[model samples]
Target: MMQNHEEHDHHENGSELSEMQLRVRALETVLAEKGYIDPAAIDVIIEAYETKVGPHNGARVVAKAWSDPVFKQALLANASEAIVALGLMNRVGDHLIAVENTPRQHNMIVCTLCSCYPWEVLGLPPVWYKSAPYRSRAVNDPRGVLADFGVALPADTAIRVWDSTAETRFMVLPMRPAGTEGWSEERLATLVTRDSMVGTGLPKNPKDA
Candidate 1:
């Protein structure tokens, strides 16, 4: 009787959310009812992702690499170690590889099998990133995928897609825009967007940002 009541309540409350969100809500409801988890703790975790450990961490890392040649070298050679040097290590991100977006080539990150993301750096994966369409199209139609994101690369530029896995994740080091020579790391960090870091979009133009 209680289970039926819970299921009814779940359906009543879940009409507006996506299927995945509904399922997660239902699971959370069950766990909370059984005393296995606290809903307040879940709220805290979501708050931390929203306000505390977010894209700013990744932006700092990107800015540091942009300003420091040695750090850039280290990042390209061993991303996991480089990020750890900046103290951004976390449980979900055991191994991370950094890819550079150069003039001739671009890089994009995706997890085709699942939504395996670098949460330590990126905080939380965006909703579209976990959607089925993106997962299927990121590898199969990267150019179109990028176009949909409003990133129009030159026809000559080659696109490289990296698949994220449970053991290894990837981050993109976007090319620094021109006309920003001698800029402070703080200023550069502000120009780094989460989408740019994800390789779905480009960094904001200095003038526009």
Candidate 2:
């Protein structure tokens, strides 16, 4: 009975969101399939939303992980369980693995076959994420791909690519920005962006936010 009640509540709370996601996904898919959009234009739109607008739930998750060490440990250990346990997601379809950005390594996500995204946290995948060139280049030429996104990592930082399959998706836990010490989770979430969680960009510096 409790499980059924939870399902009922989840559907009531999230049905509209799910529907809109479907509509948006359908529209973007149709446009991309018809060759009506340019990949560069798509990148610009994503940039405009950086820090200013984004998947709030994902940002919140990122902030919580940043502020809480125990939670971060669990999140890095098992993203699907951690997110669901936090009440941020009712379920995680398939497996959701999380990779963290560190001084020695930067993690990026790609779905070479298709756009297998963690819609529960990050919302719909961006157009650039689904493009053919991005899928091919993210693995073969990661540095060049980051350059196109205007991201310049340190020469010593190794870029690690996590490929998403139909049954497994991934998210990036970006390094917390400096000058954010003692900041509230709410304040820190403002620094998280969709691209940062995807690994194409970094969280907003505290000053920038």
Candidate 3:
């Protein structure tokens, strides 16, 4: 009887998964039929984001900045140019701005109107970042949103929320974790996370890394 129940549960789970895939395919078909989206173009974009471009690029940028104060200064001064120095200037990165999170100030990014993310640097925007609740709350109540993401800041810490637009996008430069004064850029890059760049989470601790 237990074996039969387990088999039935597995079948149900697989059925649900297939159903979700079908729904996604149907949506894609409808969008394509209406000429609102090109399936081939989408495939290319997805492949680029998933493989050629991603958080690794952003991580490298962060690592370099963390290790070099001069580069960090240049980054804060002209983020778009600084990132171009790292070869991530094309595709939704025409105007990029880097906001630093300090001891007294926290930074977060949101696109209330649309999901205008820094795909060139951070790759795809996470599902949560594109959600209605996060969009509304990230601007309306940033501290509360951070708390929901399990990011606790001091009561005196000021939360700064940056709204992204079609023309400009923002990336959060999270504070470097302590106790790793001589770490290599390659090692430090591993500590930087997608969420940390998006301002929803912090960098991985050295021990955790």
Per-residue alpha-carbon lDDT of candidate 1 for residues 156-190, written as tens digits (9 for 90 to 100): 88888777655678899999999789999999999
Q: Assess every candidate by TM-score.
A: 0.75, 0.74, 0.74
- lDDT value for model 2: 0.79
Which candidate gets the maximum TM-score versus the true structure?
1
Evaluated at residue 102, the lDDT of candidate 1 is: 94
Please say which candidate is ahead in TM-score: 1 or 3.
1
Candidates, ranked, lDDT = 2, 1, 3
Tens-digit lDDT track for model 3 on 83-150? 77766444335678899999988888876432357867887776578789997777667778888988
Provide the lowest-lDDT 10-residue window in model 3.
Answer: 1-10
* Candidate 1 stretches greater than 4 Å from native: 1-56, 88-92, 112-115
Query: CA lDDT, every prediction?
Result: 0.78, 0.79, 0.77
List ranges where model 2 is wrong by over 4 Å: 1-56, 112-115
lDDT of prediction 3: 0.77
Worst 10 residues of 2 by lDDT: 1-10
Question: Number of clashes in every candidate structure?
Answer: 0, 0, 0
Error of 3 at 166 (Å): 1.7
